[model samples]
Target: MAKNKSKKKYISGSLLFLLAFCFYMVFGPGRHRHQPKRQDTEIKNNEAKSSKDNTPLRELTTFTGKVTAIKDGDTFEVLFDGQPEKVRLADIDCPEKSQAFGKNAKQYASDLCFGKEVTVISTGKRDRYKRVVGTIITADSINVNREMIKAGYAWHYKQYSKSKELSQIEDEAREAHAGLWADAHAQAPWEWRKEKRTKKQQVSNQ
Candidate 1:
């Protein structure tokens, strides 16, 4: 009877050991069933928060400020948060300094942005001169760059960038023979720059 009792105790102990091992296998350090769901919830919440934070109603591409000084027909330096920022009007190339319409272009640009607070919308890059090229808009919602083109003081560079409305306005201005449009014989500013450089080189060679 004593031996039989000892055997029964041994068998019961073995059964308990087996049960504990099975339990450990299902809920041990290697188990990942519950962890994945928690991680998934955290990721979703973070994504939602990021989306909300970045959602824009109307994005101003660049900072808004007052136009302090007009440099040329298509370029000016704006007085922003504190410092002066040079900005070139995108998609509009005006007469060169040596051209007939040069003074008119500078005067027009000065009239448009000088002393007025305007929004500078960027095209995401800068020119070689480190000026942030963009379209300037006034508080009254006028696109000064497009206005210059429409008034024929400028020609469409069509290279830096262009919007549909601006392109159309420039086309109409060209067709209507406005401002510099009065003379179709004028060369583009880019071509003029090249010619000026070539002449300078010839003079230097001489």
Candidate 2:
């Protein structure tokens, strides 16, 4: 009778141990499995935030208005909807006001469309200064942006423009020694701007 009692106690303990093991297999691993799904959800959320941050501010559009002011070779002001909006010429970068041929570039642009009605093929993008970025078309159907490069008053600004015609015209102008290209060692407007900024930073640091 004592031997039978001992066997029953051992069997009861083994059954309890098996039940505990089964419980751990069903519940313990299931909890860890949910952790990966939470991590995946977090990763997806971060990707969505990154995509939103890189989106453009606006869509592309066109606007027609009178050229009210010429700020420089590549920037001007247009009288649109009874208000003056600054416009930055697209696909071209002209010399700075203090750079070589800068005055010539400004004069050429002024002669082409200033005080005349023109159309702007706006990329609907605004620069850091809140200027509208676009291509300008004069009343005479001339593309002012192309003319600037063709005449060598401006660089093709390849970082922003991929127009084959503009690139080809710029090459031809360089070969012909047109406008700024007449200078053997002409500095691009972007480089000039960078140098100026560097000088300003150095001065400030000092």
Each candidate structure's count of clashing pairs: 0, 0
Q: Please report the TM-score between candidate 2 and the true structure.
A: 0.70
Model 2 steric clash pairs = none
Go through the candidates in order and give each one's C-alpha lDDT: 0.85, 0.91
Residue-wise C-alpha lDDT for candidate 2, range 1-206, written one tens digit per residue: 99999999999999999999999987888779998999999999999999988765434469889999999999999988787788999999999888889999999999999999999998588889878999999889999999989888999999988889889999999999999999999999889999999999999999
Put down candidate 1 lDDT per residue, 1-206, tens digits, no spaces: 99999999999999999999998989886578778989999999999999987764332257899998888898888888787888888888999766989999899888877899999999556778778878899989989988899899988777765567778888898899999888879778998999899999999999
How well does candidate 1 match the true structure, expressed as C-alpha RMSD? 14.0
Which consecutive 10 residues in model 1 have the weakest lDDT in total? 53-62
- How does residue 28 of candidate 1 score in lDDT? 80
Task: Name the best candidate (by lDDT).
Answer: 2
Candidate 1 error regions (>4 Å): 1-61, 162-164
Clashing pairs in 1: none
